[model samples]
Target: MAKRGSRRATATRQQRNGKQEPPLAGWRLWLKRTLVWGTGLAVLALLFLGVAVVFAERSLPSYATLQATQPGQTIVVRARDGSELIELGPSYGQWLDPDQIPQPMKDAMVSVEDRRFYSHFGVDPIGLARAVYVWMTGDRRLGATSTITQQLARNLFLNSNRSLDRKLREGVLAMALELKFSKQEILALYLNKVYFGGGAYGIESASRKFFSHPATHLSVSESAIIAGLVKAPSRYSPTADVDAAVRRANVVLSLMREQGRISASEAAVDPSAVKLKKDTNQNSVRYFTDWALPQLEVLLPDTTEPIEVWTTLDPGMQNAASNAIKANVPKGAQGALVSLDRDGAILAMVGGTDYVTSNYNRATEAMRQPGSAWKLFVYLAALEAGYTPDDRVKDVPVTIDGWSPRNSGGSFAGEMDVRSAFAYSKNTVAAQLGNEVGFGTVASMAKRFGITTPISTYPSMVLGSSEVRVIEMTRAFAEISAGGFTVEPYGIVKVTTTGGQVLYQHEDTRKAQLVPDYVAAGMTDLLQTTVATGTGRAAQIGRPVAGKTGTTSSNKDGWFLGFSSGITTGVWMGRDDAKPVSGLHGGSAPARAFSAYMKVAVKDRPVEQFKTDLKLPEWQMEPDEEHMYGDPGDYYYIDEQGNLVEPNKPDQAGQMPFPPDSEQGSAPGNGQQPQQQPTPAPPSNGRPGDNPQAASDDFLNRATGRGGGTTQRTEPRQSGPRSVTIQPTPQN
Candidate 1:
């Protein structure tokens, strides 16, 4: 039973051991596989948790510390007494209190830029996913997931480089900004920081540029148009292409409707109804701007600061001046006008007929001969030289150093008083007076009057041969209008920061006594006479006015410079090439234009006379005896008997009073008259009665005769009574 039981036991044991061992091996293999799989699952779970942590960290708000540095942008505008006229800016940025921005504009911006802007915390997950999906699908859409806060961050803290890294940075900055600032604050920043083209950076500038109004006044459609430009400003720029801009605006309207930001009915309205104000390029006042530029800089030394320039210019006046020249200027002619206050404050200046055609600034840049208008200086010099208006000067042909000047009509009056000569523009009289007063003296006076150019003391210079610019002449004449106080014309009155910080203020520091008040007054009187009755008659404005007309030689240039109490204006008309203008004269064209302009300019203003207190010296004419005659060919006579004689008639005995003495020593009528008889040949010693001696004494007595005296003559009186007595005349 041991052997048999052992064998059975061995088999059973072996079976059992084999079974157990297989189970153990199987258990080991299963354990090893389970352990390996479990470890892998744990590792994978940890990895996923780490990735989720990273993504969640990215999704959370990143509080980036931004350095809010405002870039330098200047807003230049011309204003006067609380009214704005011309305005220009670089990077059209305008910072406004949130309250100042129209609610419609804000709503439009949110609707177009980011519909979920108000709800998002810097990152819009839905919008981001959509953008990613679109990008992955190769559509390459730029509808970023960035909210307004994020855009503000990108504009404020990040570079504009469009790279993945930059985008991430933008996103991080945006989140940081959102976490640090409220939604309203972010919107305000974004609205002010975004670029709107044409050097405009903010909505305010863009609004003003496009609508010619403030951002606070933007209409719903106007707001929509501006919001639409943020995507691609140049593409939607009203100036670049209005049609394209309108189309883009319509798309914005559609987006607004799709987002429920606007009603479907509203979106259904005609796209044409979304009227965008025309963009004016802000160059209409280029000439005016250029003119005001230097003054602005001078007024505000720090141009980096925003400032307002209070000017004297009225937009209406400027437009009138511009249009007048444009309408009247010939096709080939170029012209300019400068209107200013008597105090030298510039009101309006048109440098050229059109700034687009040329910015040459003919009003201030062009230098040309002023023609007879310069004769005023000659008259002024004469006034200073103790010459009176009534003093007569010969207007006959005159030559100086071989130079003979002719009048405008190539004729001359024999003699004319100063007023008539000046009125008629007699060239000879002007040249003569200029010569007498000394050309250097006149030039010196012109210098005091604000002429900067060198004036040569040549005879022709009296007739305006020296070239001078319109500005110089205008300013010079303004001194006369200002009652002899030299004035420096300036366009800028004051400059200030956009925030109302005063930067600079112009001082009337350029004052000097250019001429005596009385002298200036006299000249003004003469100029007034000119406008009233002389060549400048066309410039008469039915009011107290003073002016001068200028027509350069060859009819190549014409000018009318005049002033009323409140303002002085100068107008010039001529060909750009300096060629002759047919039938053109200052009195005909420019004077008429001047009168027309002044009539409008001074209509509402009070009459202002030059402030002066000096008394004028009285002027009187000098006598000329040589010219007092009837005829050079006529004759008159006195009889030998001391009786008056008539012309072309002979005298009888009684008409001749007494008879001639005979050679015999007695009167012819009575042979021996007691008194006439040779009283007695006194002393024959070669004295009174001696032959040659007596004759010499008689001649001496006759030559030195007193009331009643006698003399002996041998020569027969030609064509009248004969004298028989002969007398020898003394040598000495």
Candidate 2:
């Protein structure tokens, strides 16, 4: 026994040390490795799945939380000056109990939104499979099949942004909803809370908005229309398009018949029965509220209690912005304006000339080419890459990939300094800068400047082929105005519940610097020069101002973005259909509107000089011989050498004769007459729009902001800013 024990001990020691145990053959060795690796992989997969599950379910609200939320709560909005703007919400209609809801309404909703409402849990795997198949086959005419519970989940807790994780969370919430409430309760919740567009929410409000009645009196055809709206509220709202809404209702009716909820005869829609209400929500600040409301879903998704929103909009500035658009925008064309403070507060926003005629928020929605205003990004990129505003860049004509950008002047001048090129809005120099720095680098520069829109790296993109929203473009200039820090446009300042509970407050903190101080100063130099003696001269208001002008292809879109008096404003004028307006350039009506708006908007704000480091060449505004009969402020550039130049002038006898800020009023936008315009420039080559000039004497006189001032330079204001209902408190 002792001998056997010794032998066993020796074998164990050898196995540990690597000798006694014989190695397994090929199959055994392979099996051992497979088992070890398989176990490791399995552990890793489990860990990853656990993390994913936690991430997906992290933002899900509890069933108790959802139950505690108040229904039909009103959203009250107020402007910066403490005046109420509007009250909007589902509370506009009467809330109905489960039994109070019409049977046809419930049936129609179930038939069109979810066919298997009674059979499936919150999630319907069969429906999901069918949707997947439809998606793979590219046939989406048959809408998605989110169960009533699933729809409740999203409507209650989630926003409109779609993502894979959002879907997962939705599924989990749907299941939780099914576990917490009965199917009938879910249906009632959906029918009451869903948005039916046309500023209507809840079945009762939608019924009144479309058919001038309550939900209880809605017919089967009306029920079908309301059900179809769930798929696309704006597209099917009868108030928006009567014919489309009627057609969608017929489709919903057909589905109801297929589901055995209605007979074929009842499925047919009667166009005569669909009567759209002409009385619209004509709230003057509706554009601002509509834009700010969606942000609430993102900011406080955890709560459903109605809240009061404090926005950054200045009523005076808003009025001035609207009046400017009306005065400057030609008939039949649309215009938008966005004004921002240095901290990114949206001081004023005008989405269109008349929001009553068109509710579309063009200031925040329309994406159009920025034209020469896009040069800001190009020049900013170059400045950051160690190029200076004083550096020489080629402006001679050149083509790339069969595409060549032509200057608005129709010809490119020879080599010129960066500041001169940017001031003159030279297209060739911008294209060359884009190629030198790489188009990708230029795009990155645009992104850095707060342009969130997608930009293609094609050569033409250097010339502003990419579309960008007016608000974002204004935000980009605000960044530069903010002394090189990143700026993000924000409208809402604070939000509080009806019970005075604070839900959200905008935090004021310093943002990351997007560019060095030197680069931003260089950009400022270019912009100031543009407004001082370049294409953006019309935007000047006596005091030093910095701005850029943009005119897209065929004069389809005109823009003027400028900053002064610690305020940055962007103006866009274009046709809604993207069609050309005859002879519209950034310097024409758009700049005129900017001139008029800023003159009044900044009356109370302090005048701040933009920072610049580059030593600009001496230049002066000399009277032009050709435009001698034209309006004053026409001028030509004459260098110190006494030789006439394209865009530069010596500051000798030809110094610009602009009036001081005090001469007009004590500050910008002051309610007083503007001083005389700068000595005019001569017409070069005996052609119109071919001469370098300061702002016309008439435009400089009319440049005003948020106060009482004359805006009539070429066109007069037909009417003042639109009016709105000021609801001081939410109506219960």
Candidate 3:
């Protein structure tokens, strides 16, 4: 024991003198080596991360553009009063301050999206572990576990491509963003940059678009609704599918309640009661904006700069028109309505039922046969050719070029005056007059009034066989409203940059007279007979009205074009595929739609008479005594199909196929009786106007919160005695 102790002491003494080391010293040396290696590896990892960050920072989109508060970041469209109408940009909404963000909104987002948003350092380790487990098992439907800061980083500087490289780069960038921006700043950016659907790119826009209120005023339910859209905006859009949207919002509310962010009572509000205000900037607004967006370049010369456009759209008128169509038109059948001032400023335009479902602006894009509506140009040609409204015209059936034109009611009124013929929508008179004036003259008259579509010189051109856009037809009618002055339709009133520098200002483009004032006066007098005592009686609004009613062969297209002194509107309804509506006719849906819209549009505006020099043709006013139908009620009845079925007995095979409603009667104008058939039962829906089966299934589903079924609402008041219904022919 003494030798061992002496040896150990000597070894210690020798170690102190730099000779032999103790046995345990080897373990100490091994630990030191391990520490050094680990430190070097850590240093290398950090160095590599820094280099990668530098490279990624260089590859990012321009930082100034990303952080810009104007132009590239948010392009705001405004109403004339400087109210924001819409926003167009990848990142929209006001850049809210951290202090300005409501706590409830933040809490709801955090609870539903990332509970550790405030706690995590750019990335959550636990979340990463769980994500790995999910990914390894290929259960990708579990969604992502990215932190809010990380999402901001991805939204700002990262491509959404999924790859290990992208993920690493994202992680690096997320850490960098964390270092650069404080947590509040990061949260603010995230909130401002997130997409909330319905073309809204930020919380503010989403709130305004959905609730018609600003983000600062959003209620707890509203905030949850907006928050729930972060995952799939289009799928969860309130406008697209209200039930789905509410269901998602309920999920968010439940999460908030579960996380103790809200009280149970606060979450107990009925989801159905969370009524979203109807969006005025929907399809109708989009139609005008889309037409005006391309004009921005011509107006601005440099579209790169942010600009504000003042359009001619009257929000009140637009809303009225949109509501009118929505309230009156049945589902499945597409309808378009346009309201214009005499000078051709578009007051309102509704292109279709839902712009999201179908962007094809029927008012501007579709070109369909104008049916009897085309008779305006034909009558104008006849007037120019020295035909007076009182002149007697043969109403016997006539066929031109293998095409036989028939009126809505299949009977002929023989030897009726021109005014009475037009009032009754007599097909035989219209066809005969077209032949007399020459199709070329009629085509020329239509062109002079702004009908730019190809006008064939074919005889059927008199019957609106060739297609013309609704907008085009509207413009043509405006010329007559302008007292023969050519009116150029325009929507944009002004364009200016955000800095208030004017880029474009509207100038009246009304041109010199395109039609003789006398001709216009005569035509107005003739058309007024339509609204006063003819097929267009449904469109009367207790004022002087002049317009035409139109229905095509097989009832495929229906139209009503009428004008007061202040506004002229054209309404068209039909299937997109040209399928015939079961019992549809011009005098039904289109006429009532016209009446419904005008009744609101003309409110508060002074009622004025159409300016026309009533140069007495003296003879034009004489009622035809010979062939006059006994009573208006005897002339028509609402058929099961909603069409006005005339009881005209068929003539011999060679006689004119069937003449439309005859003004006088069947034989020579001496008060002769016409053959007739028993009237059919009216539509079972009790209303002559409503298409019960035409309501949208999707709309009904959302309204009732049941999938795959429809509910019927009571028929609205009708302006006429007959209703138009449509039945579609199957596609090949």
List per-candidate RMSD values in Å. 34.7, 17.5, 23.2
- TM-score pick, better of 1 and 3: 3
TM-score of each: 0.51, 0.67, 0.52
For model 3, residues 141-240, the per-residue Cα lDDT tens digits are 6558678877877776655666778678678887777666678777777777787865577788788788877788878988888899999875677776
The CA lDDT of each predicted structure is 0.66, 0.74, 0.71
Off by over 4 Å in 1: 1-72, 91-284, 608-732
* Top candidate, metric TM-score: 2
Candidate rank order under TM-score: 2, 3, 1
Q: Could you tell which candidate, 1 or 2, scores higher by lDDT?
A: 2
lDDT of 2 by residue, 135-163 (tens): 77988565466788887888787755566
Order of the predicted models by lDDT, top scorer first: 2, 3, 1
Candidate 3, residue 435: CA error in Å? 1.0
The clash tally of candidate 3 reads: 15
